[model samples]
Target chain A: MFLIKHEVQVLDAKLDKLHHDIMTHQENILILTAEWSYLNQPGRIESLARRHSDYRPTETKQIINIENLPYPKKTSLVRGRIDGD
Target chain B: MVIKFDGLKSQKSIQLDGSVNKAIEGGRNRLLVLSCVFCLAFVAAGVRLLDVSVLRGLQEPIDVVEPTKENLKIGRAEILDRNGILLATSLSVSSLYADPQEVMDINSTVEDLSTVLVNLEKEKLFKKLNQKKRFVWIKRGITPMQQAQINALGLPGLHFQKEDRRFYPQRNLSAHVVGFSGVDAAGLAGVEKQFDGRLRDGSEPMTLSIDIRIQHILREEIKKQIINFNAIGGAGVFIDVDTGEILGMVSLPDFDPNVLNSASADTKFNRATLGVYEMGSTFKIFNTALALEAGTATMESGYDATRPIRIARFTINDFHPQKRWLSVPEIFQYSSNIGSAKMALDFGPKAQKKFMKKLGFLDRLPVELPEKGKPMYPAPWKKISTITISYGHGIAISPLHLVSGVASVINGGIRWPVTILKKNSQSKMFGEQILSLQTSKDIRKMLRLVVENGTGKNAAAAGYMVGGKTGTADKQSPTGSYAKSSRLSSFVGAFPIHKPKYAVLVMVDEPKGNKKSFGYATGGWVAAPAVRQIIKRSAPLLGLLPVDEVSPQIRRLLEIKTPQQKRGNQLASF
Candidate 1:
């Protein structure tokens, strides 16, 4: 009984440490995503591109349509359009 | 008895000694076990406490995580000209907060903070320190320098929160159309208010009908004239003739959204979209078009413009006072009020109202601007109103409404709602037909004649085939009567009359005439020249090709017989 209880306590400590490590990793990932979006905004990208590149970037006016997209090979898992009537 | 005592004593002594040693051994063993258990428990408790209080923050943890706040912004979407220039944007700034619990050296801290934060009261900051709150806001949107100084004080508990603030970078440049964002980022006026939903929440930037470069030209030239003539206010607009887009719009006395609280009401008012004025002879284009479209008049049509026509309580007279019969083209070139009134009489009020309604002049304009005015029209639809409105005196409409209407007149007679969002050219073009293509062509001819030989002669740019109308309406006093002296001068013109591409409108209110203008504050004298300057500067930037001044096609399309009165005279000089 003593040995079992000792093992359970050890497991609990290990679980707690894992939780902290996972939480810290998640926080870092979220911060990175926010930074990525900020840097990717067109105004900032255009400024950087103009500074470094000889060619001016062209403005895009296309709106992606679902029907025009390619179908996935795993057809069995695919369902009806996510955005549709 | 002595033998019995010796025997008992010996046995007792041996038994007692043996038992005492055995009991001591057992007691020691139990004490050893208990000591080991207690030590283990103490170490476990200490480790758990450390993990909770220091590592895992299960106890006494600092609440460093920022709470997710609700977005409380209500302001309109910003309008940007085509080039991604910041016609409008939101700025994020640091707002100061206080943590009373952390504050030490309160009096000194307050004194130091006051030196950096100019608007803050030292006494108030000191009073805040006396409060029991864990946190309180010291000020919203403190300058970075102020924040740095506050930080230098090392006052333990001072904190800051970031706030998003709306700003118009191109301040007052396209004031009327771009509008201004409100304190909470809600669209209170112009495009900001009009497309608030798209601007407030959408991921993409909103593109407006404005061209920043053209907008700058219009504003600079208009400002020059306003300063030169000492005008009360000036407004200008540019439109794409083909797309029905407003390229540039400006209203002087514009406010900077950055210092909104300090700006006066006059600065906030948008004259181009909100303030409706009697556009005077600018409306003659509509009248002439309506007459030709309804078959009530033709290019060969003549009106007796020899004398001023007396009506019930009004007498219609031309500013130049031509005392002879006028052809349709001559009437427009000369801007004959009598002739316009006669043409309106033939067309009748019902037709005029219908045509104006179809031209989108009756209701509030369908532009992506929130501050547009609902046009003021007479309820009774009286004949006098018709005659006066024909010459642009009785009805009042916003300059934006006029721009859209004129675009329809020239853009193959189609009315497309002006927009601020950049659009894909391939998107199916949608517009309502407002006039016959033939009528639109004929109006173009007459408009070209005005610039070539009419009141709009001053509006001509050397190579750009400019066609426009000049208007000088008598300003009405607050007492509901027209003032004899004050005038509201305006000019609306389009370029490359054979194939119109852009329209420009400039209006100046209460202009004090100067010597260069010969003490004249009429539209031709004040506003037309501003239009000319804007075109001269914006033409190259727009990439419009400079044409031969006397292009054969332009000359043939804009032919006008020199009137009999001026036939022998040197080409009537401006």
Candidate 2:
């Protein structure tokens, strides 16, 4: 039983390390997303697109706040339940 | 006989049975054909199973779980000054949390943690462990050293959640303009609150008009003077003459945004932008500007400054009383209250109000800062109020308000919004033509005279054409009376009058008379020298060339009329 308990402890350590690695990867994704948005700023993107890509810049108005933002079509489906229920 | 016959019949019957058996055999052959067909079908089914399982093994396997970990919310954008200085930013900090299921000895871990983090509550830590939660926070935003020490304890279930803490790198250097953030990282005051949404967009750094270098110089000068004088408080502002940009603004008794909890209300008070006082003789510049703009006075126009004018139980007299005739230039040079009152009388009440309104003194200042205070003008607009305001006593306005108006007076009469940020080339110039170009020129000529011959002689920085006005007023006590002993002394001046670049102002509140001031803490003695020191230090930084004393620009700007020089009479160098 003592040996079994020791094995369980090692397994737990491995599980914890795995969880930490996953979280670290998740954080890296967030940082990449932030950097992507930073690069995609209207001015920066336009300059880049003009130099290296076929995409064109479009005029955008400042959305004053989050509450006043327009809703997306697929947003309601996020909870995994359908409207029929 | 019947048996024998039966035997004979039996043979025939046996023959018949054989024929029946043959027929039965034929049926059996048909059944055997059906059995063969059934075996063929079973063989085909086995071949189909082999084809599906073995031959199709190269095809991709169907997935059991879907991958959906791409979308997450982003944090707010950073705010930086024009030169890429970090005015506001976020730092990643680790917060301690725990999972009770993995904990070996909760009591020992809690005890060790509480010792490291002295502020941690013992009961709370014990309760969190006993509550049977999988995870709970022990502390938020512990320093890295604390985290390392806690980790060294090898406590089970101890974990950390990485968080972003907003940091102001410049600290209280420009607190009033940069403002501060709340615990949730929301802007609570100043520019942070005004541009809150823009900051959250995360597109680019929000650049402000403030220059950290200029801000440092202005704050240092104000702090030095405030300390030296041992006064209650003071404020200083440096404004661009042509563009109306506020290069620097400093209010004494400012607090660091990082240590905001220990700050008092007075420390948080933004005196330069929010505190409005009856700016004494600084308004004389405006009064003279109005007189010149209204064509009410010429440089040579004479006003009697010999006696005090008693109007309705209030006497208007110059602090340095000159019981003699004075010209318009002389009136301004000596900062004579009687002569200024006469000039205001010449402009009259209607014209004076109209001119001040044109300067944007009657409303809130137009700077980008949100901590602006409205001017306290008289409600009834009486003649006495106009006359008293002429010498700067009745109407109260902020130091920023005075700086903007003074910049207009020197920058050929264009009152633009004072800016902290450097203006990009695309921004169009904004202001109104309050004074004619000729009137601006004439005022500049006279302001230079104040530095040369008048009470502002102490405000001279050698080789720089410095011109300004001195103002001293009694501070009103709480019981509806003016305190005789307390005074607010202020000086406002600009350099190289021919081509003005900056306007600097220094104001001291309730300064006591020290031995150095010879029992007199008036603007001329106390505030003028502060302005002189500021110019001596700030001029070279602004890249202003201190021309030769005999340079035509200096000669024309600072020429004051004087009687033939006596043998002992020596001219001041600034």
Candidate 3:
């Protein structure tokens, strides 16, 4: 009886600590998500890309379906290794 | 037992008398009674102790439910985009308040707060702290860094209360959709107001259907056109035609929800869903579709456009009049007001009224926002009302009404209720089929032809098959007369029009003519190009695969043939 009561006491204390940790982690995650959204605002990123990088808005003409890519030419077949097939 | 009684000392000691015997008996009985009472109390106490420990333990279980989130009452809930980008969130921040009566050395405390906080009115603070009152707020929302500095000061009477401060990290990006909340963390506007109970009670974050990236693109494109044309203001919305999800919606002259008080009423007004306006010739899309669906008109049906129709001191003229007989497809292609009005007459007012009501045009927009506008139309269904409403006059509806209504027409004629929340992928959606499949297909072809060879040619984005209608309405002045000098130019379109996935609508209020547009402040000149830019840039991000424009399959879906074309009549190939 003494042993069981002592074990419950220890487990209750540990459960409380875990709860506190979970709360702290949730707060931290929220703060981090807020910062990420703030930094990645569309207008700010667009201006930054324009000034420091080669990225441009994708044009409609640039987009194509995956199936539209031509299949590999028959003449361009590689010289065979035993396992290359 | 050494029993000796006081009766032995009595006068009856001379001989053993009956009195002595009686006194002895009485004393013995009293001693026995006292002993019995003491024993009963001890026995009762023992039983009670046993019952509390052993019996109760078997009957009831110990409660060990671990309370996690309930321990801390810090914030309400968060709002995120469909992609899980946070749009609105609340953080637990310390609000500084002071008990004026407890404030020791007010001058020093004021000096300490003034330095730590920017834009702090020192005089106001000093006056407030000098009062005999118990509590007063120094500042409601303060940064954690400033809070740390105040804590370092270690001033007496200055206390902090933990409260959640609502933050719009996206700023003005989704102002009208996500809306704003009050200082008490209660929602006041937009999605915040719509789902206030869920946001307040539940801990899980709410996800909106709005894609924030597409929202930014739509806003930027609309703002550019509003500035370029020097228009008063504008609103735009894009709906997923298949799913009835609003992908991106923008209203210019929009306010940043962060600074609610500074924005004017005009800027705070959400023009997209809350402001109803005459949508001009865009209603012809409905007129033509209804005519086909009612079997009053066919694809090769003809209407005379030789001259303007005059009725009851009102003359309906086409903007680009052909002055010749036009087929049903040609009437839509040219946006003929006379022909559309004529078609509406043939169909009559009863079907038109029912169709409009079925399309949700007779009621307030059934959106989640509190700022929704009620559509305006003539209460008494008259012939003139039907005629004018055919060309989108004598009626007013919000831009969202047009977008969603057009969506139903194009997406196989089903009227799905629009929603702002991101739907779970597995949820089945069902809506009433309002028009026939053949009518929907025919309307799609006419819409494509408008962009291909008619007034909406400017709306064509490369590789993505575009289909649309252009609208230019005369702005009504305060005196209830049309102002010819001012115009409302708008364009509404769907992309990969053969099988549309999205519908984009843009409307510019009172745009002025510019040199590039050949001094024409029309829908083609002002609004169509903006829709073009939005559809082009956002298509790739939306996972739309562009197809070959001249492919045989694509041409077959959008091709139109008229009676004049079949007969090779002497007419312009429009």
Candidate 4:
């Protein structure tokens, strides 16, 4: 009975340590998420993109409706090309 | 004597034996009772252990864990823009505090802390540390590097408390909308104050309808115009007409929410929703829409603009006067005050007052911002008051009211209560319809005409089908007279007139005209071009495709006949 009580106490201590570890990790995750949000502000990203990349914000004239798109043209196929290898 | 002694001894021996037997029996009975008691206690304890481990294990563990002080410190939820970009958030910062009583070597402590927290004055630290009080805040919202350096000091009484500091990542870009929280993490202004309880619960992020990109565009455009026109201040608002969700609301001379306490009251004022003004000719949209909805006027109905009408010492005239009988469309296109007054008189005071009340002009605008303006208008409905109010003089209201009212006029006659929060897709879309479908259609045509052929030509964006009205009202001077040179030039516009989606209002306060604008500080000269630029830039971001202006459907809807034909039709009707 004494041995069993001692073992149970040991297990409880282990569980407590695990719980504390989980809490600490959760706090770390929260901090990381906040840092990520700060780094990903739109104005910062836009300025960075302007300096380092070819990408720019989309202009109104670049956008068009689907109805304005041209139809695809038909092309003739050669049947023997498949067995060329 | 020896025999008596022996007999006594025998008696004594017998008594001792009997006593021993009795003692043994009593011991046996006591042991049995004690054993039974031990067995029952063991059984009870075993049952309790089993109940706790197995029976109660099947159910949730009701562990009443006490919340620590750190856990009790409420963290505010983040505020995100429509695209999930962070506008406002709460970051956990270690605030430096001191238990002055526990502080040893006060001089050294103050010296050490002041070195790490450079912003804190040494003299102030010395005075604070010398205080008889138990606690004092040495500094708050310290950087992580400073916290680490202070921790390295390992000084007694000097401790760091984990605190949540509200952060506005976009800064002044969304100052008025995101608002600022107090030092205690309690919301104090704007959306922060409006949804304080929800934010305090630290639930999921609150997503607003504001798009950061659109907000940036509007602010940049307004700033440029404010500078170019030499205006003292300006405000602009962009709203989704269908959803009634505000996309971008910019009030310039805006302050950064991050440093809100030091910002001036004027800088913190939200002009878009709070500042009330006599919105001038923009109110004509309401007058015209009301007349059409009442069936008292038609598109071809003519109003006499042959001369300014004198009514109760006030001469109602037009800015660009047409000295002839102008048709209903002509009246709207020209923005003739005389014609609008006549239309209002024909509509009658009773109906006009009812319509104005329905449009939400008689009270403060129901918006999320705490700073709101109560509309000022004449108490009694007099004849001259009707005439002046028709031209947007006697009645004063916020730009938000005008935009939302105009949105109702063009958006299938439904008046959706304006909101800053994003609407969920599953929610209902239709608001109360205030006009018939035919009347709404006619109003849209008249607005389109104003942009295509009349005063709001500068507000037109090519391929966007922009339609709107211009309003230039003179500011009421402190001496209770209209200031001639000081004007509030505003342009209220919407795009894709056939299927309106967004409504924008741009108002430049006290704009002075330069030589390039021909010294005319009118709405067209000062505010309209800014609206055009805003539409042109923000259209693509909103996924709005610019349509061909000359398309058959669009052309047919926006087509207006010549003045001669309009007159001939009017003559025929007579």
Per-model tally of clashing residue pairs = 10, 5, 0, 0
**Scored by CA lDDT, what does every candidate get?**
0.77, 0.76, 0.88, 0.85
Residue B199 of candidate 4: its Cα lDDT?
Answer: 91
For model 3, the docking class works out as medium
Measured on C-alpha atoms, candidate 4 has an lDDT of 0.85
Q: What is the DockQ of each candidate?
A: 0.02, 0.01, 0.61, 0.39
Considering lDDT, where higher is better, how would the candidates rank from best to worst?
3, 4, 1, 2
User: Whose lDDT is higher: candidate 1's or candidate 3's?
Assistant: 3
Off by over 4 Å in 3: A1-15, A76-85, B1-61, B68-74, B425-428, B563-574
- Checking candidate 4 for backbone clashes, the offending pairs are none
Sort by TM-score, best first.
Answer: 3, 4, 1, 2
Models 1 onward score TM values of 0.74, 0.73, 0.87, 0.86
Error of 3 at B78 (Å): 1.9
Candidate 2 per-residue lDDT, tens place, B1-574, comes to 3457668888767977889789889999999999999999999997887776667746854642332332222355666665656677655668898888888887888888887888888888888887777988778777789989888887888999877766666777768887877766788777777777777665466777666666776777667666767788988888888888777788888888766789889988889989999888878888988887787887667789999999997888877676887777767766789999998998799998888898888999877667889899987888898889998988889998898899998888887877766688998887887888877877787777677666678888876678787788887677857786887888898887767788888888887777777767777777788888778766766666566656665676545444421311232211
The DockQ-derived docking category for candidate 4 is acceptable
Model 2 steric clash pairs: B209-B420, B209-B421, B210-B420, B210-B421, B246-B419
Off by over 4 Å in 1: A1-85, B1-79, B99-107, B119-136, B561-574
TM-scores for chain B, in order? 0.83, 0.82, 0.88, 0.87
Q: Name the weakest run of 10 consecutive residues (lDDT summed) in model 4 chain B.
A: B565-574
lDDT of 4 by residue, B454-493 (tens): 7788898988999998899989998978887999999999
User: Which pairs of residues collide in model 3?
Assistant: none
lDDT by residue for model 3 (A8-83), tens: 7998889889888887787777778888898889999999999999978777656667788788765555544434
